[model samples]
Target chain A: MTKGTLYLIPVPLAEGAEHVSYTPFQLELIDHIKEYIVENEKTARKFLKAAGLKTPQQELRIHDYGKHVRDKVNYQELLAGALRGEDIGLMSEAGCPGVADPGAEVVFEAHKRGIKVVPLIGPSSILLALMASGFSGQNFSFIGYLPIDKGARSKKIKDLEQESQREKRTQLFIETPFRNNQLLSELLKSCKPQTRLCIACNLTAPDEYIRTQTIEKWRSETVDLHKKPCIFLLYAG
Target chain B: MTKGTLYLIPVPLAEGAEHVSYTPFQLELIDHIKEYIVENEKTARKFLKAAGLKTPQQELRIHDYGKHVRDKVNYQELLAGALRGEDIGLMSEAGCPGVADPGAEVVFEAHKRGIKVVPLIGPSSILLALMASGFSGQNFSFIGYLPIDKGARSKKIKDLEQESQREKRTQLFIETPFRNNQLLSELLKSCKPQTRLCIACNLTAPDEYIRTQTIEKWRSETVDLHKKPCIFLLYAG
Candidate 1:
């Protein structure tokens, strides 16, 4: 039997938003996969069920490897089934895997073993936010999450601003849901007043809000994003 | 009537590969959109027809842009239908719009007019290639296209390598289809032997090939990518 391919699956950015966020083709593809490496099995099972997976959840072989799964895992073991001609999928809890998520290791392994890797189209908050922000689409960088410490985070934001100015590159980063407001406050205080900031909140959801404004304008407005997942993008150029 | 939203639509990377590259939702969305701001009206109609558009090609209101169609388009005029409760879709000739495409102008205008912008998930050769590359996803930059001049291009490659080494960021860029092999040859000769490069060719198609190797390893191989669209990624970290 030929070695099976590994599929990089993209999931919805938020719960209950799949209908609008995912294409029917993505859903159909999700249903056919028998083995999956996901950020969370519980969340993955829910997504698969919503996507119309026919197999019983108990019967499906799932390897969870995100924050919750603490046990040391052999990355090669996850792809063992694929090597034996059983196609497998790598999924993240939200958005596309291997993108600010944990599916990269599996994809890296697939490359090493010469196994074909197919990336399916689905909701990716980063790309979606960038598409909507109207920022510099030609040159941009995704810096993942920001530093947790206050001083470091502030310094990093300034550095990113400097880089954006120098390279004319848009800088993108995310913050924890609850710290959404704090990050915004930090950005408003740290970045230059003229630096443009795009706040994409609860993307692809009913409450989706994406706005790009100068830091000065954002500072003047009374805003409250208590616990919504948000992506912050700043451009000094 | 409520103001219609702006949809950032994704198109196939290449011709005749829509079935596998686009999701059913994307196709359905295309069928429903009456007005489209595309890279080219001719190509947009062809794509719509292939995606099962029910409207007659002549009846579809398409405003062509890109390298041709010299009239300076009034972006607000293109979106006037959306203000009148008619949903408008911004589409590129290939891949996701607003990214290395001409769709960002409309998205920027949408924000100014307070019109909702909905980004539908679909194939993005850049993201797909990065997902498959196993590079530093934590920090990565998309530089779009490099300089065409020999000296400038070489200098830019060196600068990118230096940035990648210092920041541990993955650098991504694309080339004109016919110049794929030329870019590869230049990269092999200009970049350090140990610098890793991943060439993603004909992404999301039957002949898709994504391979990563040291610059030295690629130097000895025979490659011919005559006119295939490709994404090139490199990292020194």
Candidate 2:
């Protein structure tokens, strides 16, 4: 067995470095790591450049995970890299790694290999949205995205709505940037008038919007659906 | 219009300074506030004592929330406390202010009265559990606590399990401390053998355990049912 470690570094939900405050233990882990892996080499360089003196843009190399093929991940090669007594930081495009991103396999493999894995807290839209949604939190789930087809998506909505109403669960899901309008319209058209919806738009940003209202109210009113990316959630009594 | 600030203070899971790491910004928010509405009198004293000192025994003055009974909150009295230049820190017994707590009513009321509500980042089991579950985060649901009655609870589980399978959603829920064993047994008994289960126990603690296994494996395993405080997560693929 080789000694290795994996850092699941959570990036900010939105831009700006002020929000990336790692806990004392987490920062220490990052500072001691010998190898760094970022989603994009360019972004990794920028992060290092911002650090001024101690940051390693050159020595601590980054792996290029091109849009994550979701199939062709070189697990052994990555494991070989880890076996070289190097620690890797798996950075997601945004939010927590492995939640809606490409770090799941790496985490799973690392665990299988008995490599120590540490996840640093920074920012997460899923948790932030949940905090403000005013929904039941004892138990909740977050499915990253949904089918784009209106028919398939509508059926999914119906199922989620039934779960929310009949099971006393709060349903949470999101959509792509361009399809938000279509999804919002479908939500208004399908869900009952009394079902509660919480739309967290551009979370952790200056123009952040956390709007909660009934579907009836949303249908009667006009909201700028194009303003930002959103994590739309529904809660039914 | 009355102007006031609503602070979302993150308390520890258990009362201890080591268990909490209040950020500099959060501490600053606490220091500047003269009027704060805490959850209870003892917690108020605990906060005050912890705020200005290095430990939990220091002296600091904090206003108690008195109670959470809807009619007994005396919203007008709290408003008066705010109007008189009180920076109200809506503290909960544990975790963040909103989820699984009663600060939402105050936060909502503050929003209605045009108060500035600022939420801080701290320990939240919901976020920690979801992060480590490794379930599909794209679509998920959170149902708080389940009914204890065997018949009603079993029916609810069946409905939730069916919905999750139909929609491929992750159903999240919790149980009372003493009822965890009963719930786990019910989950294994009612849900299909192939249904995916993720149990997050003692999250964020050194004794934390998060396992994702099928219900079939769970039924035959020698799992200790004495673990009281835990979160049960179901994912039917």
Candidate 3:
């Protein structure tokens, strides 16, 4: 018997942004997938509904892979349905699955089982930010998050800045939303004066803001990024 | 007076893949924007027509930034429409604008002129390949292309494998379509047996192929990748 394919679906970066985040084809694909492995069941069901899932919410089979259950879940058991010829959809809490999320483990498991993996197109904040950053997209790095330790974070920032200058590559990283302001101040203090910095906040939202400016110019201005989803890009070259 | 926003648009990576690559909101936005700065005039016009552009092709203003004219083009003049309060769209030959394309220069010019930059949702091969590669997405780098010289390319591949093992970061890069098979052979020869490699070709197309395996296993298989657009990802961890 042939194994069913695994579809990696993407959720919107922000709430209520589905209209611009999903394509008609994605909605049609999801309509045929009744089983899913999602980061969070509640949000995933809500998203599936938004994406026009025709199946009743309760009738659809969902295996939660959220933070609380991630460690205890069996990777192979997740693909058992696919092995039984049932197409399974994989989704994260936000953005694309398998990137900056625990979904990669499931995808890896699918590969081990010889199942086909198909990735659909959707809104990815990291990709969107890089597109609007005005940086060297030819060579870029997305380092998920910096160290939480103050000293280590500072050192990482400086290292990224130096590498950016030496290689002429764009360095991208994100910070926790509540600590956004703190990270912003730290970035300004840690990077060189002439390094170009681009702060993209609330991507794909009504209040989206994206701008690139030199560290020197940013230091002279004041902006609050507290509790805002943002992607910070640095390019010293 | 408020300057017009610079909309960075993305074209489907493969021909006739727009149905799955673009959202309805993107089509609506393009319908209203009659001016565009594109890498190739012929392809861009064809893409716009496929994307549901209502404006007559002859009535639209297009600034060609194709390879031959890229060096001679004055970027400031490309944004003349936006400067005069008309929204301008920026597109590349394929995939997202301002990424691995000459569109970055135009975006940078827009930032310098204080024009707002908005990125629309679409398919990005690099992002999609990472999503399905079952590799580390937490920390990844797109180094664009490796050195062309035989010795230099070999050394670079070894260095990337080492870096991937040390940092647990996925290394993504591409080769000229015709050189894909050559690069594949070089990678199998330069890396350790356990290092994982994923080759994603003709992404988002009917013939799309994505798979991951260790170097040892890949050496035992035979495949042809000549003249096919592809992305190579490495993960030694």
Considering every candidate listed, which one attains the maximal DockQ? Answer: 3
Overlapping backbone residue pairs in candidate 1 total 0
Assess each model's interface with DockQ, reporting 2 decimals per model: 0.62, 0.34, 0.87
lDDT of 3: 0.92
Q: Put the candidates in DockQ order, highest first.
A: 3, 1, 2
Off-target runs (Cα >4 Å) in candidate 2 are A1-5, A17-21, A48-55, A79-87, A111-117, A138-147, A150-169, A179-196, A214-227, B14-21, B44-71, B79-87, B151-165, B179-196, B214-228
Ranked by TM-score, top first: 3, 1, 2
Best by lDDT: 3
lDDT score of model 2? 0.68
- Candidate 1 C-alpha lDDT tens digits along A174-208: 98789899999999999999999999998878888
Query: Cα deviation of B230 in candidate 1 (Å)?
Result: 0.7
Candidate 3 lDDT tens digits, A76-151? 8888899999999999988999888779888888888899999999988889999999999999999988999999
Query: TM-scores of all models?
Result: 0.93, 0.81, 0.98
Task: Report RMSD (Å) for each prediction in the order shown.
Answer: 2.2, 4.1, 1.0
Quote fnat for model 3. 0.84
Candidate closer to the true structure by lDDT (higher is better), 1 or 2 = 1
Q: Write out the backbone clash pairs for model 3.
A: none
The candidates, ranked best first by lDDT, are 3, 1, 2
Q: Report lDDT (CA) for all predictions.
A: 0.84, 0.68, 0.92
